[model samples]
Structure formats: structure tokens, C-alpha cells
Target: SQSSVDNMSCPSTPSTPTSPIPYEIQIATEDDRESILNFLQTFFFRDEPLNSYLGIITEETPRCLDLENFSLKELNNGVNLKAVYNGKIIGVSLNGILERGWLGKDDPYKHGDTKFGIILDLLERVARESDPFKKYPDCEKAMTVKILSVDGTYRGKGIAKALMAKTRELAKEHGCGFMSVDCTSHFTACALKNLGFELHYSLKYVDHKVNGEVVLNPAPPHVAVTVYTQKID
Candidate 1:
């Protein structure tokens, strides 16, 4: 039942069902940026399919720069969600609102390098072409789940599923008609699908042509960028 959304891709993870863990969800504040980014450095950059292909977490690279830039950009001056357990931040969903035609135009901020630029370009294209809000042209608001990261210590405890559940409520608070995510992690797309997010479009890495070549040759099961969405209630 796992399906791709649009462009952001994720590597499929082997299902390991586990009981849900206890945690509390809340909207994030500016002060929490440092802690959330730190957690992502350990889990996302090292594990995110596209980031790994771009050498984002390589020792030779500046620490957390790529991850921070990508995730933080979606902050949109704040409206993020976090999962706390015993006073520690175990998960995050960096969010933003995508107005109609937001993707039909160019991104003002230029990506740092060819690697980043190419990936962003690919995703942007699909987002505009296969916009989840296309059918509901009057639906001006689309809540964007820009980045979702969970702590390694909390993995397999259903932390991600819990966070996504809260995200729905948060989207409603933001007055969004639907929630959207460009899931680059394969497991994430599958999990969202299970949570009832509909897969809209997908672009496989091998098929994403760059000068007629497949530059992002990520490892197995990390095949394509998937976009998923669901109406918020």
C-alpha cells in the first residue's frame, strides 16, 4: 500500500510492527530549533536517501549545514510540531503552508550546489504539475510536512505514527484544508499511507534524468521521490 507522493523520495523500510510508545505532541517554538536540528543530524542526514547521495553528512562536509538549511527553510517563520518523551524531543515535523500556485513559480532561494539544486528542481516540478490541491482549486491552503525525523533511540516504537497523527490536528489548527508531505524516506511514505495519506505522484531516481544520466544512485529500496497528501479534518 506504500505509494509515492510527488518528488521527495524515501527508502522503503522492512515493516517491524511494534506497540505504540507513550509521548506527548506539541507545536514547536523558535527556541527548539537547535535541539531538533541536532537530532536530525544524527538520524536524517545519515539516513535520508537523497541527503546520503549528496554526501550531506560526510565527514569532509560542514556539520549539519545541509540538513539544517533544508529543514529550516520550511519553517516559514514557525509552525512546527514535536514529540516529547520524558522532557526530551524524540520527533519533529517541520511544517509550512503551501498556497495555491506556490509551486507554479520559481523558488527565490537558490540551492547551494548542483546536487541540491537538481533534487529540489525535480521535486518542485512534480509538486506544481501534480499538486494535491489541483482538484480543489478553491482550497488555497495546503499544510506542508517539510521534514519528519524521529530519534534513533525511539525507532520502532511507533513514534513516527504518533507524530503524524498529531500533525493532522496541527494542520487543522493552522486552518489548512489538506496536509501534504514530500516523503523522501521510503519508510515514511509507507507509514503515511498507512495513516491514510493518499499517494499522488512519484518520480524514480533511475528515471529522473540529469543530462540523460541518473546521478543520484542511492542504495537499494531508495528508489523514488513520493508525494502523499490527505484532507485535514
Candidate 2:
């Protein structure tokens, strides 16, 4: 299945699916920051559902620093993973460690009125209301998948699944008790569900409004924002 919001930043036309290539999953390091950023810019920024819905990136404005910073904020956390094919980075799972009582600890208005700020606000609301920490109380820390993306040509080839599986392993090694992912894209939600992540919370876009106007109206097959989580065993 295609696991990303927009075929994981795939080109408009996808390549044939029969050729399965060998790829290695490895931890992304500091030196790989620029490569990861460049990969995300090419494959993730333009096609992510919310970014597409809000026109966050356009011909005039090709980059949104807010989102880019958000994606890279936890790169040095040692939980991020990348899939490489012939030395080319084709997939990424940017993850972060979430401690208990992490909610309400930051200034929600830090991004302030920007489109990416709106997204952060929505995710914050989910994290607060769902309170995954509360659900998995025995554990004081959890590993959260902040971003999951794959090259479009590699879609339906299990790249995303591999990335997520590696993330789960990393969570166990990092002493986390659970793994959580806030999925804004339907495809990602479905993929995680198939991998045994349970639905913790869900908020429909229509219900999330600002000034009575629905701010994000993603296309069909992408409806609500959801949080899916699984315990680390």
C-alpha cells in the first residue's frame, strides 16, 4: 500500500511496481541532515496532505521553515531512521522521545498564525486530550513518530513498513514503553493500523474550525486527524 499522504512525495506518474530493490535501514546521523532535508523537500513537503490543503508551499514559496524545523528538531535524538537504496536515501522516520507531562510545556503560539502553526496547534490538542501517557501509565516515556515519508517510486514496496518496524525496535532500545504516531494522512493511519497500532484519538477536520471556518479540507481518502499508538514490548 502507498503509506504516505501524497504517495510519499512521489512524482505525478509512478513507476512500475514489479522491480523490488534491496535497501538497508540505518540510523540517520548528523552528517545526513542536509541529505534528509533535501529528501524531505523533494518527496514530503509538496505532497503532505495538510501542506497541500493549505498551499503551504507554492511556486512562489517553495519552503516553509516552520515545517522544516519541526521535521528536523529531533534529528539528533538518535531515534530517526532512514532507508537507503544504492546509497540514496529513499525513506525516513523522524521520531522523538516524549516524556510524561510533556503537554502544555511549550508555548503553543510559538509559530503564531502561520499555517504550520495551525497544524502544531491541532496536534497539541490531540496530544493533550488523548494523553497517550495516561493510557500507557506504567511507562514514563514514549517514542513518537514525528514524520514518516517514502519516495513515490518505492511505494507499495514495504519501505514505510520497514521504517516503522525499525522505529519500534529503537523505541524498545531507548527505554520507551509505547510508540505513538499522530497520523494526519489516511494512508498513514491505515498502514499503522495494519501494523497493529490502535486508535487512541480521532478528530474530524470539519469539527476542527477556527472562527467557524474549516481550515483544512484535505481531499477524499484523507479526512480526519488521528493518533495511533502501540505498546513497546
Candidate 3:
């Protein structure tokens, strides 16, 4: 496990995995910011419902910006990972630990470059209300998979799944009691379900309207925001 720790934030060109899909997992560092940002901007920077709902990446949508602020702090928290192949980052997972009373506190969301502060408020409220740890007693450790994204070219290769698998191992190594993932992508929800994470809470897109006007109608398949959790052993 110390090996993983040493690899944290280090850009070492290590040996590859034995699997047919050759990706090397390592903890990301500040030096990898540009690479990570560029990769995300090219793929997941504005790919989510919130961003898509506001057209954050388009040339005409002057109302918003990308979701870089979302995971930058998670990297500082030192639990993030990068999946690389051929010296290129193909996937990433931003992770953090949630302690007890994590909800009954000041919101950690930074509102700069956001499309709407209201959406953040609503998300925070719903996430707090849907706290899975609230149902249990003496549960103090839970690792939150804050963000998971993969390159479009590598979508069907289980990159996100492998990144999540590493999250579990990282959680277990850090003595976390469980792992939690907030899935706004329908495909990701299905992935978590296949990985045995139970859907702890869900809010359909139609239910998250603003001023009675639905803001997000993300293509097809991505119909809801789902929170999923799986206990770590």
C-alpha cells in the first residue's frame, strides 16, 4: 500500500498492467494539472448535465464556464488518481473522505465561473438530505468518489470502472468504511450498479426544475442524478 502512496502525485513511467488493456494507475500531482485539464476539457469538462444544461463549453453560451473548479480541490485533498496509457492520461477519479456531520456544515462548493448558484444550493440540500450515513450509527468513514471521467476514445474499455476499482482499494487502504459515488450520468449509474453499489438516492431530471422550467434534458439515457454506495471491506 505504501507503494501506492509513494506513487501519489508522481509522474513515473511505470510498467503496465498485465490485462489486455494496458493502463497504468497512479496518484496525480499538481504537475499533471495541464494534462488533466486538457484531457477533461476535450472530453468531460463540459460533458455533464449541469454543464450541458447551461451550454458551458459552447462559443455562444456566455453564461458559464467549465467544471475545473469541481475537482481541483479534490486533487489538493490527495486522494485523486489518473489512469494513463502510452504516457497519456486516459481516465481520472477525484476522491475524498466524508466524515460524520459532513452535511451539517458550510457548503464547500465554490461558486466562481458557475452557471447557476441555485443549482449548487439545490444539489447541496438534496445531497445532505440524502445522506446515507444518517441511517447508520457510528459510521464515521466514507470515501466519496467526487468525480470520475474517461476519454471518449476509451469509453467502452472499462476505464472508469478500473478507476473506481482503484478507489475501493485506496479507500480500504485508508481505512474508509465505504465508498460513495454521485452519478448524474445514466451510463455511470449503470456502471456503479454493475459494480454492486446500491442506489442510495435518486432525483429525476424532471424533478430538478428551476422556476418550474426544466433546465437539463441531456440527450437520452442520462435521465437522473443518482447517488450510489458500496461498503469497503
Candidate 4:
């Protein structure tokens, strides 16, 4: 799933060009933590649909510690990757391994009243209902993209796609049988679809409610949270 607004690019496969895109996809390690966090603050924290709708980062509160923690919790995982151009991080894919009963095992939400917690609660619901593990019985484990985002200035140039492509390779190396992403934005869904991921589940904002109140009311086009998966052959 994407927590970044740059998914608006929804790029197609890169065509032959006069020169290369000037970026390289590389494994992200603990050393890159600060840079990745800075990149995310600029590219992801403010405009992602849920963050925007919930006002997770606002003028009064410029940062959300919980969200920051959630984003970086798996940063050191060998599967996480970043796209760097001119020595600057332009995109990142924070991935983690999920074993066969992950849905029923992990608790993704703890601070239910906090905006970040609320967002995680919704995602947990989506995962529980989708149950990707059950759908792909042969997949003993899978690599899940927790956060996928790209710098706005570098989008529409296939940076996000390149990051995902690299993530797929990393998944295979880690022995994952499948890979999945939850698309929190329509643009992200379109991007994943272009990369051949199958939509396994979706929940429209209008249909999700809390105490009879619709919790999310993002602008048009980002109307649903969707789960997409691809077997790693």
C-alpha cells in the first residue's frame, strides 16, 4: 500500500530515451534512516489520502511521531529499497515479510484514538477481510509493501515502478512466494495495475464508518483502499 501522494504519476513502462533516468535503485539500510525519514516527510506524511483526511500532520503539529515510528519500524529490513538520483533519495519501498497466518497473528493497531492508529485500524480491517494468505494457499510467506512513495518532482518518470520492480527481485531473494501492496489511493491502484498486480480486495470510504459516522472523506479519485497481489514466479 502507498502512504505517499506521488503515486499520481501512474507511469507506464519506460521507453528508449536519449539518456537514462539518472537514478539507481539500491537496498536501504539503517544508515539511510535519517535521509529516508526526511524524504518521507517531504513526500508522504502530508498529502497521503488518509493523512490528509485525518490531518495527521498539521500547522499545529508538524509531525506525527507514531506515523514516523510506523514508517521506520521496518526500515532496516533487507528487503526495503530506495531510489537515489544525484545522491538524493527520490523514492522508497518499505517492505516486510508476512508469514501465512499474518492476518490473524499481528495486531496492527494500538493507539486507536490517534489519527495514525485510526488509519492502521482501517488497514487491519481491510487485511482481515481480504485474507490474501487464504487465497494463495501455496504462498508460505509473502513480501508486503508497507509504504511506497516517490518524490513529486521525480514522479511520472517510472521511479515508483523501478522501486517496485527492485522490490520484487528482493522478494525472490528472500524466498517469498508472493508480493502484495495495499493501494490507498486511486493513483496507486492504477500504478500497481499497470505493474500486473491483481486486485484482491477493496473498501470504499463511503462504505466504511465509525459510530455511524464516515471516518474518511478524502477528495474524489481516492475513494477506496484496495489490496493487490502478484505471485513471485
What are the candidates' C-alpha RMSDs? 3.7, 5.0, 9.2, 4.2
When summed lDDT is taken over every stretch of 10 residues in candidate 4, the lowest stretch is: 1-10
How far in Å is the alpha carbon of 44 misplaced in model 3? 0.7
Better of 3 and 4 by TM-score: 4
What is candidate 4's lDDT per residue for 156-219, written digit by digit as tens?
Answer: 7878888888889988988899888888887778888888888788888878898899888799
- What digit string (tens of lDDT, one per residue) describes model 3 on residues 72-101? 655766678999999999999988888877
- Model 3: lDDT of residue 10: 22
Q: Which digits, one per residue and each the tens of the lDDT, describe model 2 over residues 17-102?
A: 55678999999988898999999999988888988998888999998887887788767778899999999999999999989988
In terms of lDDT, model 4 sits at 0.84
Ranking by lDDT: 4, 2, 1, 3
lDDT of 3: 0.72
Candidate 4 regions off by >4 Å? 1-19, 106-109
Off by over 4 Å in 3: 1-19, 60-66, 108-118
- Please report how far candidate 4 places residue 114 from its true position, in Å: 1.2
Residue-wise lDDT of candidate 1 within 179-211, one digit each (tens)? 888876677877787677788767777777767
CA lDDT, every prediction?
A: 0.74, 0.84, 0.72, 0.84
Ranking by TM-score: 4, 2, 1, 3
lDDT of 2 at 217: 86
